[model samples]
Target chain A: MLSEFDLIKQYFARPAAARAQADARIGLGIGDDCALLNPSPGMQMAISSDMLVSGRHFFPDADPTMLGHKCLAVNLSDLAAMGAKPLAFTLALSLPEAKAEWLQPFSAGLLALADQHNCTLIGGDTTKGPLNICITIFGEIPPGQALRRDAAQVGDDIWVSGTLGDARLALAGYWKEHPELLRMDEAQHRQAALRMHRPTPRIELGIALRGIAHAALDISDGLMGDLGHILERSGVGACLDVDALPAGPILGTQIQDIRRRYTLAGGDDYEICFTAPAAKRAEVLAAGAASNTAVTRIGSIEAGSAVRLVDAGGQPVELQLQSFDHFTSA
Target chain B: MLSEFDLIKQYFARPAAARAQADARIGLGIGDDCALLNPSPGMQMAISSDMLVSGRHFFPDADPTMLGHKCLAVNLSDLAAMGAKPLAFTLALSLPEAKAEWLQPFSAGLLALADQHNCTLIGGDTTKGPLNICITIFGEIPPGQALRRDAAQVGDDIWVSGTLGDARLALAGYWKEHPELLRMDEAQHRQAALRMHRPTPRIELGIALRGIAHAALDISDGLMGDLGHILERSGVGACLDVDALPAGPILGTQIQDIRRRYTLAGGDDYEICFTAPAAKRAEVLAAGAASNTAVTRIGSIEAGSAVRLVDAGGQPVELQLQSFDHFTSA
Candidate 1:
């Protein structure tokens, strides 16, 4: 029975100081025309927005809690890519109807991750429409210190934080040619589904790699496709070792072709793929250790173009793997 | 042939120094995980997000250019209400399909208004989905100088900028009794329709009234409803003179009832309504002149509870007026 404004006030409007932990960046939060953020001196504000529409981004009846987590997590992954400390986020949520049962768990899942990352919900719009969640996050990074794709240099070792392919494996039902894979053991399926639904943003690893990694990006699309972006922006190529990729444990007895394709080209990884000088291998590993995230050396940037995948024998492997293009693919 | 990325690059990504002048706030733009904003010292970043769904917010075949303009204008009006200077914005666009014909004019109209306000489109996500445009705008305001709704005192005079009701009149087809009103001459209809489409945010007036206006807000909903917000926040009441409101010229021959409802309670005005002390009337008028806007005194703040509307005879006029509630209204 709550109006839109009432729904917002009761659910989304958190007290500025409640979970912010003395961070007075938010001058005014909800109930105003705009939320006010007081930036720290000498700090640049990093911002990114992502939209997730039902049927396209998620199933219409996906778990509300995980849906909430994934929406904020993807945006946090963007901030992590920039090595920006999470500050606050605004949610412009469009819902088919205001149902408390759905909103309760959704907000719980969202605010849980927000609190873990020291981020606050500042302000946003909640309207009636086909379900769509668009979140814009603001973070802080030192001026001139942001890791950018254009800064990747030749000879830089490419590293990925955390493992890849788990989410895609969880979605093997949509992978075609893998109908039996959905019959995996309950525990393994749960693990893979968790990875698909609740991706960690790798915030600490990103912060630790600020000066060590020259260029970085979060893999949302497939590894081949996302890494291709780095190559295109940096005007360089990569020689990736298919066998060296840290893949998910769910691919226990899968064939090399399936493993290679999933590991080298699967999407929804939410892992940070970064380029760094080979000399900083020890430091990169140390950063990985400090952040408690596994850092795997998967490839090296080359002067030429084309992201060439190689087998364990160092021979070229040919595979047609394209990133998820929402428009063209759908 | 264009993917979401291509559509963004060809249209929304403006050159680094296009119209940002000497401001170095945007350190990075499109193609990055996040855009970086370096706020000026001693300034607060003001942010607001607005979403316009295709069917709910606009006609499916509405002019893409005007839709773009309105999308950004509403957010700019939020900044204007906060007495903030425009900084940058992020656009999260969900499209049913990527057509250059639609995107070209859409981006052009969006960017033109952004350029006019010195706001740069920094970074956002574009995806294929149901048509929805969500824009989150950032602006800068000095500490403690932002016009707040809770700052109005009991004796402050209420003022509104420019005229109202033209927009609601343009859509008078929804007004039930207004089939004949739409038969006005082409120029009149054009003027009214223009008001309905392209709302000019009173940014300058907001900045100029920083120290003068005790409280302020942009009227997106009807006046009576929006003024109730200020009264509620300021813990006061209002006595609005219905006849003193600045109504559009197109409503010259309209009946008193229609004029009262449209002028006093119509939505989509986008005009600034502010409260100032009676002694600061000259200063308020001066601020209005400096901003090149007409300021009309339509009401006063009082130490009581209801928003009472009085007619020309100084008699109380009883009418129920409510603002547009996204959920309840639709």
Candidate 2:
């Protein structure tokens, strides 16, 4: 079995990716207890952290490789929500026992995703426990350009990228329970698992939307509950058009129902949810195009104080709204 | 009892400490789900992480408050070993169940230490599991002045600070077993426990020794074992004067007779061990004095292949050193 040190050197350590961006002054990365990063003058850096516990966030017996990818991906999502460009990250791994096979594939998956996103695994601690991985990501953004959660304004249009409910369906063990999900062969199952394993961090899209987004947040808490943060913080109300939502094709009829609230209140979509003025709609779409990311207008902001969703019939759709609270258990 | 949100607001949020020499730009400190840092131009930021798990790093019933303190302290120790100044930190907290009383004091202790050191608890994740606390710390230094374990050279002087072996002894509950060990004072028992609880991170002392020290590391796994890390990495050997080691006063004549061996191999001191040239000995002492942090010379770097302990009689100390391994239990 390869030791932790060997695992890191084989997988996590990589040469400079694209020369550390001119603005990013990373003098040293990988091979040390810590990575060093230098940002340009007057630019503010953002840091965020998330912990994924086995059995709590993923299946206890889930693939270790996927666990590693998901850990870094979730942390990158937090940085994206703040319009921060990825720089580096740290991991703290807790496991019940050390298994060489698990560690090898896990490190490979983590390092691959990290390289793709231009994030370096700077430092971490490994200890024995009930399999918990905590990741803290560091990123940089120009001063004053960060899109805050409290900046949403009345009359702003809400937008989300990509289709929702796919990760949710995948989490339901759909691919594991039904062999039809394997229609595209082993590669297809792997791809679907990849989406569930390593969702892309929309950092480029976020950086492009810096000035365009009035209020922005990651779609980790479903749409309604997360959008509620914008409404509550901005002291405004929202009118979510159920029909305009970008639910995946799996939810054919319920797409416009507004009551089946997985996409609305189910968590872990990791998509960016932003609000902008109707006049800047074209600009927002252009920004997404420039970043090669998608954008779909799903709702509009209003002057009232509550977030209300309207079904296809233009009638208020009153659905029980909640979020995936870390402290509150199922 | 306050909810998680309220607890975070009441304790973790604080103003960033502005430093002229520190390169880590912590703009937004301890609010939202992440902290914001803006690095100074031409300066690089160093980061490190450490995780402490129940029944692994500490006793399962360890005080929650002290656990928080030690978690952050160990990570800061890494920054200190690298000659970096800590700017901010993120904590990933996992618990078997939600207990307001436990979390409140735990957060308070963590925030107290962070505020004292000018580092803020920026962001963290809280979940349900066997208790584990992982802290990731951000520190800053000049682009290339970081004292690293791989930089030690032969013919340099070795130094350590404070004393060692209290934590290891306390681990066996030996101090509690013998009333005479603590001068029979009940408070002494608590003091020993406190040492195991809140370890002081040697940041100031480390930063002060910046230019003088060639290589440095924290004495986490004992003087001999941790110092061996530097020698092994630097491809040098070390000869320690076992009689010159610094040991706590708790041990009696019997333990003191072999204090050199235990101090050489005991772990969890959190003190720093560094190498410097004998020519700059006065300057190093003056620097430690200026900061009011004691520095004691212990041994010397030698042109050899491995670490060795020499007694007063010029004979090698015969003992098998045992250090804690994060991956496996003995």
Candidate 3:
């Protein structure tokens, strides 16, 4: 069996020259008790952590490459939500055993996404246990310019980036939980599964919306639940047009009821749900155009503290769509 | 069963005012997409991550409070080794279930240590899975002042703080693998177990040795194995005075052979093994005194790349002791 040190050295440790070219903010990369980072002057470090367990977060025999991509992708999504530039990250991994076959693709997937965003792997710990991948990501952003959840204002336009519900559609298809309801072709299944396996963090769009959007967050635990966090923290409410939400291409072909449920409460989307002044609609569209991402205005911030769901004609729509809760709602 | 949101709000999330008083570097704490941190100007951030699994790192039925303390203690030990001041930490916890009976004391132990070090728990993630605790800690240090592993120079005096081998002694007693070779009373058992469960981080002593010690690291994986890291990185050797090693008070009563094996190769000591200039021996002692930790000179950096152990009369001592390796050792 390979020792822990050899495992890290073989798979994760980057060459010195490659690491130096990855990011200059890294004062010390690895092979130390702690990795040192120097945040740029006038910038605040944005930090977030996420843990992906074997059975709960992914399949027991899930593709190692996709698993690696998803783990870092989730964390980087948090940084994107903060409108921060990715600088570095640390990975704490617990594996049952050290296998070169598994680690080779895993590191490739992880480092590929890391390199795409110019994020360096600083330092971390590895131990023997049931498989768990925990990542703490660090990014830099100018102080007071962060797109905070509490910054959403009354009468702001609610916008979402890209499509939603494809990841959840793939999950539902995989589990066969709604076999009677979900009917997908082979290509649709592959495309939806890809959405779940490889999420694109909206880094460029977040950076583009820095001063344009009022507040924003990544939609991971469904739009309704995640947007509720922004509302709860901002002490506001929203009036959402249920029929106007942008659904994934495959999901758009589903039945109207299924489209409504999946688009409203589907988790793992990784899209940005943000709010901006109604007057900045053109600017918001330009920002989305600049980032080359689709932006759709689906709702508006309201005065009261209750989220009202309305149909296309503005009539209230009553539905019970539960969000994904790790503990209570399986 | 509580939802994930409810569990976080009930157990881990601290009151706003309490969090504000804990750390000023935290610009935005929990309830956001990511926490924001402002490093003091000219101070570099030292980051480290540690993961602790239930059965592998601790007993399945281990006391949750002590388990919590040990998990954070090990990560803080890394910051201490780098001579950095603790600022904030993020935790990602995967649990089988959320039970207040287990969480109450666990949070108590974890938060107590954080408060003692004036460190804040900025943010974290919680989910359902096999129990695992991962913490990523952030600290601050001046540029070029960190006690690095590659800074040891030839003829520098090597020192060890406090004592060693008590944690391993407790493990040996519990496993009963060497019952014929070890004996201990109940009081001695409790003392040894405390060392295993709640090892001090030596943070103050590390900060005090800022400019005095050339190279330093925490003694988590035994003195020999950890010291070997410094030797490999610095391209130097060490001549250790084996008989002069400071054994734990309880281990001091053991026989010579048992003492040698436990003191030299025992893991989980959490003491600081540092190398300082021979001319600064008096200053080193004063540094330890000011930090109120016992420091003992036990070796010297040599020209070659091997660790040589000798007795009081300079006679070589031959012994075969293996350091703890997570993958290769049982």
Show how many residue pairs clash in every candidate, following the order shown.
0, 3, 0
Model 1: residues with Cα > 4 Å off, grouped in runs:
A15-17, A174-177, A180-183, B16-22, B174-186
Docking class of 1: high
TM-score of each: 0.97, 0.90, 0.98
Can you give the DockQ of every candidate in the order shown? Answer: 0.82, 0.60, 0.89
DockQ of candidate 2 against the true complex:
0.60
Q: Kindly report which residue pairs in candidate 3 clash with one another.
A: none
**TM-scores for chain A over all candidates:** 0.96, 0.86, 0.98
lDDT of each: 0.87, 0.74, 0.90
When sorted by lDDT, best at the front, the candidate numbers are: 3, 1, 2
On a 0 to 100 scale, what is the lDDT of residue A124 in model 1? Answer: 91
| Candidate 2: tens digits of C-alpha lDDT, residues B1-330 | 344455455545433322312424556654443567776566668888888888777877777788767887888888888899877787777777667777767777776777777876667777777788888888888877998888888899999977776666565454255434434244554555566678888888888988999999898877876787788779899988877777665532325544555577768889889999999999889878977778888888988768777887768876677665665334
Evaluated on chain A only, model 2 obtains a TM-score of 0.86
Encode model 1's per-residue lDDT on A208-323: one tens digit a residue. Answer: 99999999999998888888888888899999999899888886346677778877777889999999999999999999999999999998999999788888789998888767
* Two-way lDDT contest, 1 vs 3, winner: 3
Query: Candidates 1 and 2: which is better by lDDT?
Result: 1
CA deviation > 4 Å runs, candidate 3: A15-17, B15-17
Question: Hey, what RMSD does candidate 1 come out at?
Answer: 1.7
Q: Residue B120: error of model 2 in Å?
A: 1.6
lDDT tens digits, residues A1-330, model 2? 444455455545543433443324566665565667766577788888888888778888878777777888888887887888887787778877677778778887787787788776666777667888899888878888777777888889999977665565555444354433322234444544555666777888888898888888888767887787778778899888776777654533233333256568756778889998899998999999998988999889999888777877788877766666666646
